[model samples]
Target: MKLSNSTVLVTGGSSGLGGATVRALVEAGAKVVIADVNIAAGEALAAELGDAARFVPTDVTDEAAARTAVDAAVTLGGRIDGLINCAGIVVASKAVGRQGPHDLASFTRCIQINLIGSFNMIRLAAAAMQAQDANDAGERGVIINTASVAAYDGQIGQAAYAASKAGVVGMTLPLAREFAKTGIRVLTIAPGLFETPMMDDLPEAAREALGQMTPFPARLGKPQEFAALACHALGNTMLNGETIRLDGAIRLPPK
Candidate 1:
């Protein structure tokens, strides 16, 4: 669907890839509901975008909160036309670490937030989008999920993170087929090392070294680039049920 005048709910919409998407959608003339746990930043972004955007404090993993956000999006825009699941967390504990063993709690948290949380938003939002009137082409809505290259080339100490993301990649086609009759599309974007807040925490030298792993560009990805591809996906109905990696030719080593 064309982004102009569409209503999209974006999880983790306060910052990083999500934040960039919000900006791009607003600029494209689509109304956006910024769903995020970071209320301060979310509210700020919503305010910056004025009537084109709204902020809904949300926990993607929370049934009640997620439902509320979907409802809010409908209330704000009359219907939910698109949903982007960007709320996620990462962990770096090995199966057997120096601490003796990986923390079960940590591993579970990674899955809960990244994998299960994404499914929660997808299911709920799909239900909401299902009830909407389809466009002339029988399109009800579109969903875009975020995964990572680590799901395939997981580096050292990425057991939890990799598994969670791999689950995301695994679910893409199945969910797409299940939602096919309903006219809602399911797709995932697996990004490589990008210049997000997480990367910002690293020293510049360290970050540059990581970027060099990607051929050509030889620099960290800009959030705008991610946003651009997401916009393209939203507008292209032919692209569905696949995980598109936005990595810059980077096959991470087992560092």
Candidate 2:
């Protein structure tokens, strides 16, 4: 769908990949709502984007908050055109460790935020989109989900994070098929390591070692690169029901 004049909502839009997506959508002429738990960052970004963007404090794992965010987009912009499910948590844990048992609570939390949260936003957004009049290509709306390369090439300590991301990868095709009749497209992007705030505290050598794993570019992936692919997926009608790997062909080794 053409982003111009459309209303888009991005979950976890307070920072990192979500923030990049919010900026991209706004620059593409879409009115955007930043749905995030970090109210300060979200509001600050919305304010930076001026009138074209607004912040809707949301904990995506909460169904009510998801619904409210979507409704806020419709209420403010008159219609909901797209949704980007970028809210997720990354906890490094092994299925079994030499030190002790796996942290079940942390594992569950990863699944809840990474998988269920995405589902919450998609279902609510699809319902709202189905109610609106269809657009060209019969497109009522499009949904873009953020996954991780760990889903395919999980490192030794990424069991929980990998499972959560793999669940997202698994959901794409089925949800796309289910929403096909309603003109809603679902797609996923599995990204490699990126230089987001999360990685900022890492030692320089550690960060460099991670970047060297990428064969060609030989550097950390940029949030804007991920945002570019997301925008492309939204605009291209033929790109549904698929999980595209944006990891520069790097297969992670067992750490």
Candidate 3:
């Protein structure tokens, strides 16, 4: 769908890649809803972006909350043209840690937020988008999901993280097929190492070393790069039922 004058709901939009996507969509003339767990940051971003953006506190795992966030976008433009599922959390723990088995709660939480939460938004947004009339190209809306290269190249201590992301990757084709009748496309992006807030917590030396591992440009990806891909994915109609890798030729090593 065209970004100009479109309404898009972006979860986890308070910061990181989601934040960058909100900015990108606004710049491209799209009305954006920042749905996130962080109310303060979400509101701040919405206020900073002026009228083109609005903030709706959302927990993607919660069915009611996810629907409300979608409704917020519909309220802005009477329809949701796009939905970006970026709300997620990550934790690292080995299956057999020194403490014994991995924390089952942590693992479950990761799946809850990253996998099921993503599915939650998909169902609600698809339902909303389906109700709208199709565009000239017979397209109702597009759904963009975020995965990680870790889903494929997961190292040690990434069982929970990897499984959650892998679930996202696994859903792309099936969801796309199911949404085919409604002309709602489903696509996933698997990103590599990046310069998100999570990365900033690492020491400078450590961060540089991590970036150096990339095959070319030898650095962490900028959020804008991700934003660009997301915007492109939104506009491109032929990119359904696939997961695109945004890594710069980096295959992470087992640590």
By lDDT, the best candidate is 3
Clash totals for all candidate models = 0, 0, 0
> Each model's C-alpha lDDT?
0.94, 0.93, 0.95
Deviation (Å) of 184 in candidate 1: 0.6
For each candidate in turn, the TM-score is 0.99, 0.98, 0.99
Which segments of candidate 2 are over 4 A away from where they belong?
Answer: none
Prediction 2 global C-alpha lDDT: 0.93
How well does candidate 3 match the true structure in TM-score terms?
A: 0.99
Model 2, 31-125: lDDT tens digits are: 99999999999999999999999999999999889999999999878999999998988898777888798899999999999999999899899
Give me the overall lDDT of model 3: 0.95
Per-residue lDDT tens digits for candidate 1, residues 1-255, read: 989889999999999999999999999999999999999999999988999999999998899999999998899889999999888998987799777999999999999999999999999999999998998779999999999999999998999999999999999999999999999999999999898888877988999898888996888899999999999999999999999999988899988
What is the lDDT for 78 in model 1?
95
> Model 3, 122-201: lDDT tens per residue?
99999999999999999999999999999999999999999999999999999999999989999999999988878877
Q: List the residue pairs that clash in candidate 1.
A: none
